[model samples]
Target: MNHNEIGIEALNQGEIEKAAEAFTKAIEESPKDPVPYINFANLLSSINEYERALNFFQKAIELDDTAAAAYYGAGNVYTLKEDFMKAKDFFEKALKTGMENSDLFYMLGHTLMKLEQPKLAMPYLQRAIELNEDDNEARFQFGMCLANEHLLQEAVNIFTEVVKRDPQHADAFYNLGVAYAYLENKDEALEMLGKAVEVQPDHLLALHAQKLIQEAK
Candidate 1:
């Protein structure tokens, strides 16, 4: 296989040094090709070289504006750096390049949520779930967006689905308890909180909520 393909395989196999060497060779062999630069950027990102990764991603974008992967990679780096606005910008650019994938939508939605724009995040998170129904994290985040908007019943329904899919999800149970409490179903809330505590004995929020409910009785 070519150096780029070899680099990708090595990266997938967790051979960091081999992957780096292969990617460097690939870039040297095809300096004008954006794919090598993008691959190298992804490698750097994996190694936590955020600034270097962004530089490589920018070089790839300079080589080809249509390099959607480069934009996505840069967005991820920005997200790690906690630069929400830049992350949002690059993610939106990725979408404009016709890259319609669950991950891209999820990243964009998550960035929007970080920016405190839950309303804008909702549709993208929903679309992510539509594209990949098995993504429980996306579903959970969508439920969070609904809860942020005070859509308690909808949030409870989504959180219930999350717990059903993964019974060990303590946060889902905690959110379910909170939602039930907001809906004034004290018994259901306590039951859900108990489940949360059962799943994660050290869950501070579940413990606190349980204490509050009991003291009120």
Candidate 2:
């Protein structure tokens, strides 16, 4: 089989080192093969070598300017760097290249939230949920984002859905309690917070939330 094809095989097997080696060989054989560069960048990212991964992604894009994986890699690098604005830009570029990825939209939403542009983030976050209704993390994060923006009722709704989906998700119950308190629904807050403590007694944030409620009364 061709070197690129071999690399793809190694990639699917999760033999990261082998895949990288094979992809490197493929690149040496075809210096303009953006596929190998993109695949290699993904491996580098899994290893937490963000800077080097960015270089590989750039190489992929240099060979094929419209490469979506290249921009996606750059976006991930920016995410690791906590440079949310740059991450947002690269993710948008990746989307422009027709990469209709739910995770990409979720990342974009998160980045916008980090930038304190929740208005822009909401639609993307919602779209991510639409794409994958079972994404509890996305739903939870979107709820917190909305709560931070004073959309307490909506945030409560989302967090409630999270707990319903996974009752063992203590954080969801805890955060839902917090949102309930914000809405002055003290009884519901206490009920959910008590459930959170039952699920994870050592949850420090939930403990703090309880303390605040006690102090409030």
Candidate 3:
């Protein structure tokens, strides 16, 4: 196989040194090719070499402006570094390249959420869930966006689905309890809060909510 293929195989097999070596050779052999740069950047990111990874991603982007993977990789590195503004920029650039994937949408949405732009985050998170219905984390985040917008009923529906899909999701139950309480359904709120605590005995929010509701009654 070619060096790039070999590098990818090594990366998948958890052979970091071999992968790095193969990717370096690939870059040496095809200096103008963006693919090798993107692959190497991904490897560097996996190993927490954030600055080096960003350099490689930038090289790939310079070689090919339409290199969506390079943009996405840089976005991920920025996110890991907690540089949400840069992450948001790179992720949006990836989208502008016509990349439509659950992960890309999810990351962009999550970055917007980190920036406290939940209204802007909602559509991307919704698209992420639509693209991959089994992604409960994306669904949960979408629910959070809805709740942040004060669309509590919509948030409740989304959280309910999350708990149905993953019964051990303590946060979903807790959110459901909070939503029900806001909607003035006292008994249901208490029951959902109790379930949250049952699923995760140390869920402090759920415990606190339960105490408040009981004392109010």
Candidate 4:
């Protein structure tokens, strides 16, 4: 098997050392190819070796400026480091290079949300949901973006879908409650907040919201 494939197999099998050895050999054999470097970078990133992963991603990008995987890897490293601006830049670059993946859209949307640019985040989050409708996290984030944009009904719809798909999603329930409250549906809000606290007893926000709604009643 090719060194890269062997390296991938080793990584998947959780043989870190063997995977590293195979990836190193793959890089040595194909220094000009960006794929091995990108794969190694991803492996390093997965293991929390951020600096090394960034270096490998940079090397891959230097080898092939159009390498979308390199840009995406670099974006992930920056995101893990909480450098949201840098993450957004690299993610945008990846998109500019025609890298279209649910993860790419999700990360870019999440980065925008982190930057408090919810208006800009909406389309990317929507794209992520479109690409993977079952991604509850993406749907939750999309709901948040919609709420931030003052589209309470839309936010409620997304959050409802999230909670329906994953009943144990306390955060989704909490947000759904909040959206309902904003829409002046006090009964539904109380019900959802109660469900949120039931699902996660220590969900402080949900508890607090439920108490306030009860007091209001």
Candidate 5:
């Protein structure tokens, strides 16, 4: 069988490296096929080889102007590099090409946050949370974004949801303590900060919160 067919079979079998090898051979066999390039880009990104992944993403885009994933993948790489503006631009391009992953919304939130446009990030972050409430990372970020925007009450809600979803997440607990402190609920702040310390013994922020509370006493 041709390498392209082998690649498809291997990918179907969840043998990613074998699939990548097969696609590499397919790229050699049919240099014009964008599929091999896309496959290569996906695999490289999975392995965190951003530079090589970006090269293949560009190749896929060159071969297929209509490929949304090419732009999305590139956006992801730029996001990893902290190039929020570039990432946002690429994400927008991908959306124009019909990308609709909730992750795209999450990325938009991230990009906007880095741009210090926390208010602008809210809608996208809210959309992401609505799409995937179980996405604790997005929820945590959303809470932080809200807190930064002076929407302390809303921030409290988001962080509360995060702690509810994963009680073991001490950072969320720590941040929740901060949110409560902002609200001037000293008792709740102390309690949550204590919970954070209980969950993560070495949590500096929790310890600091405890110290601050003690100093206030």
Candidate 6:
């Protein structure tokens, strides 16, 4: 029906060129509307055209200053560019614009973690988990942040939950082992590390950890 609707359908079908054409038409029809610009920006971001995507997002913001999606899109582009600090700033701005959701919280948390601000990242990650408990990647990252912050037991608990949720998660097992070792629980560390190696026989870190623990005994 509408160009915007057609663009969204084409985007969902992975027809990027068609989607772009539809979105361009939508923009020409409603030049002052920010939605098409934001949608186009999202498509560009998905294709890794970070600079052009950011420019379109800025254009959306210029049209509607309260457009939270534009800020979120800009933040996602910055994240792809590995500019974690700028990503954090835009994500924060999105939140201030009343765009509060699990994804927003997760991105902010993840960016803070990348910046090595684990303490600052904890609350956001916690909120993200509260909003969406099935995000094992977020859970694993939060566990790592806990371990880095010296919260050994809590880290172990989180890692244990991760392994329980996905038994084939070799990295979760390895992290659990590391957390146990930090707590001086050598036996548990060995057990978890052994499981890690069992799950992924080519896991060099797990093998090394196992060797170190065995020699220390």
Per-residue C-alpha lDDT of model 1 across residues 1-217, encoded as one tens digit per residue:
9999999999999999999999999989889999999999999999999999999999999999989999999999999999999999999999998899999999999999999999999999999999999999999999999999999999999999999999999999999999998898999999999999999999999999999988886
Cα deviation at 30, candidate 3, in Å, is 0.3
Clashing pairs in 4: none
Q: How close is candidate 5 to the true structure, as a TM-score?
A: 0.87
**What does candidate 3's lDDT look like per residue over 62-139, in tens digits?**
999999999999999999999999999999999999999999999999999999999999999999999999999999
Name the regions of candidate 6 deviating beyond 4 angstroms: none
Q: How does model 6 score by TM-score?
A: 0.96
Query: Which sections of candidate 1 miss by over 4 Å?
Result: none
In order, candidate lDDTs are 0.96, 0.87, 0.97, 0.94, 0.87, 0.93
What TM value does model 3 have? 0.98
Better of 2 and 6 by lDDT: 6
Model 2 C-alpha RMSD to native: 1.9
- Per-residue CA lDDT of model 4 for 1-217, tens digit only, reads 9999999999999998899999999999989999999999989998999999999999999999999999999999999999999999999999999999899999999999999999999999999989988778989999999999889998998898998899999999999999899898999999999999899999999999988988998
CA deviation > 4 Å runs, candidate 2: 12-14
For model 5, how does the per-residue alpha-carbon lDDT over 107-163 read when each residue is reduced to its tens digit?
Answer: 988898999998888888888888887788889889988899888888888888898
* Model 6 error, position 65 (Å): 1.4
Ten contiguous residues minimizing lDDT sum, candidate 5: 38-47
How accurate locally is residue 8 in candidate 4, as Cα lDDT from 0 to 100?
96
RMSD in order of candidates: 0.8, 1.9, 0.8, 0.8, 2.5, 1.1
Q: Model 3: runs farther than 4 Å from truth?
A: none
Error of 6 at 117 (Å): 0.3
RMSD of 3: 0.8
User: For model 6, what is the alpha-carbon lDDT of residue 75?
Assistant: 93
Which residue runs does candidate 5 get wrong by more than 4 Å?
1-17, 28-30
